[model samples]
Target: MESKTTFIIKLVTFYCLCTLNLFNAIDIYHNDSLDDFLQDHAKKSIPKDPKAGKLYDVSLPSNFTGMEVSVVQLQSSSVWAQGANLSYFRVPPRIYPNPNVTWLDLVFSNLGNWSSYYYNMPNYTFVTPILGISAYGVRHAKGQNGQFTSTTTKLDLPLIRHPIMVRFPSVWLPRGKCVKFYSNGRTTITNMSLSHTCEVWGQGYFAIVARVPSTHHVWKLWVIGFGVGCVGFLLCGFVLFKIIRFVEKRKIQKMETESEKSEVLDTKYVGHSKMPCAFGIRTQPVLETDYFP
Candidate 1:
């Protein structure tokens, strides 16, 4: 019993260790900062954005005048539309200018009617001096280098797309920014000031979209999964322990009962010579002699 209790205690301890490690592993995914904090490495800490002071609604609010829109061009061919891949556009990394300022990369192609649509569309007729700023940074491959390592930063503004001048926000552009504008389908770096209002030339249009943070919901899911996994593991361990103890108790009882039966038989046969007297060797011998004669 002591041994069994010891085993159970050990099992519990090991389980606790494993549980701790499992949770620690999960925490690493969510809070690398915690590790740095523990080791007194403040440099690696995740910096909070002041501009995004609090969680805000993704959709532009009623009073919002600023808007950004991304238009999808329908492919002339099929269900698989291949146009501008805007997934890369994001709030630039910390090292980049205005990490809060998310930019989209606009790609032009000749497979569709881009320039022709821009020329004919009345929506493209809007003309006011607006700055068009472009910045370029090196794209990195996974596991190849530090998460962020960009060498070049050039600012291209006052970019002329067509008849009108499209300017970039001078306040936003810095030394390490890049922009390339092209008259044809080619790419180039041109400058445009915010003072010059212009429209983009393409079959598509853009509108400012609202931004909202989704961390809370994601964290909730993680917590739920973690709790479920921990409880499941503990329940399974407990069930297994119960099954083992039950089997062992039954085995011990069976052995004890068998020993008791053996002792009783030995006691009855040991001194009870009178019990064999009726069928003893002498009586049997006498009956056989008579029959043979």
Candidate 2:
């Protein structure tokens, strides 16, 4: 009974460890708190009567120190004709909303320290924070620019011609690959147009990631396979050599036995015994030339 209980306990522990590893391998990331803050309080930083086509910086509190958020309001005609370039991002012209709303608000965010929690790239490390841009519909008075009204649902702004150009300001950043992450764990790798720029079709999270340099990699699959192959080959070669030696030894023993049977005798101890001898000459000595008496 004790042995059975111990076995059950060990099995359960093994199963639990496997489950944990499975979860870690999946690497799902979603933050409700960050989403709630962006949807609610992030836009409040904009001035009540802000200038249209101008960028407004969203000031976050001390707890969110490294992060940055900004917003810009644009008219439909202006967005359609001349898309806005709000510092870090260059929104190209010929952009239209999906549902066709009157005014649009573009909110850009840079999750500095919180990037790792919200995003992950397996076997890679992030060189920069995750940058994101989202568009929303705003209810404002007709014919008035950036006037009084409430914010509406999120809008989908699709580009007609050139893709959205996102640039990281620091030019001296280390070289890395660009990866754009979209909703529901979908990811797309993009090419950098400039040294610190990545073009995108629409809004999503973007970051630069680089593969982690290895200091020491032990117990890897390839390493194990190579080691096993070398050991197996050596073992096989050793076995073949041993088999050949054994066969040669048997053949030599058989030859010696046959020689002894055909009247070859052991060496006599004349002077320390080196040469073989016949038992008693097998037959009388024959005359070599018949002239011998």
Candidate 3:
């Protein structure tokens, strides 16, 4: 019984450890200072004008070794800005190694469109941007000179897309901090200002999306499965313990009953052996009767 209890305790401990490991494997990267990091690393030369319709060169930070980058747009209420489009390209554009291209062209058609999408980068093994070194945002004709515009240049303001809640392997943007661009047309990347008026359009800003670790989803599933398994294991242990205890109690009761019956039979036999003959008729005169004969 003691050994069984110890075994159950160990099993529960192991289950708890497995659950902890699973949770640990699922990492969430939420840097409150991400905005500061972007500001310090962002390029100052990228055009902030939404209607420029011109590509701006950007360089990413050395720490950003991710292959794929997402362009997230903030959502706006204006109807004209619904058809806005954003595009990205790798440096040194070429057509032959296209499979190794890290280019993306995302279009926003409605307010319900997904806020973000993952784009394929050059090679997965190496962290190189071989396609083009610039990104561009073009405001749709309907949105030009609309609610987001502040100047008389007839500029088409870039519109913000609705933010989305994604599953594991996807990063979430901080509140009011949506833009991520390159710094000084170099590899260092940064984020846009939270205030709306910082950019030329005064309505929306552009940002680079970060990739979620590949193992994130796997760990999430493992944690859930392990938690369920642990619960089941504990329940089974409790039921088995109850069953064993009930069986042992029954066996003990049967043994006590049999012992009581044996004792009663022994008492009856001893009492009968000690009792005198019934009616007390036994005598010693048998010797006289034989002499007369």
Identify the leading candidate in terms of TM-score.
2
| Residue-level lDDT for 155 in candidate 2 | 79
Local distance difference test scores for all models: 0.33, 0.77, 0.35
TM-score each candidate. 0.21, 0.57, 0.22
- Which prediction has more favorable TM-score, 2 or 3? 2
Ranking by lDDT: 2, 3, 1
The sequence of per-residue lDDT tens digits that candidate 2 reaches over residues 146-165 is 55666467778777779988
* Winning model by lDDT: 2
Q: What's the CA error at residue 144 for candidate 1, in Å?
A: 59
Off by over 4 Å in 1: 1-213, 265-293
- Per-candidate count of clashing residue pairs (backbone under 3 Å): 38, 0, 23
Question: Predictions ranked by TM-score, top down?
Answer: 2, 3, 1
* Model 3, CA-based lDDT: 0.35
Per-residue lDDT of 1-293 in model 1, one digit per residue for the tens?
Answer: 57988999999999999899778655643442321222121111213222211212223223222422221212212111222222222111112222122321222112111223222222222121111223322233445555655232221212122322222233332222122233243432233333222234322212111122367977998899999999999999999999999999999999999987766432225474533222325443345354654
Cα displacement (angstroms), candidate 3, residue 33, comes to 32
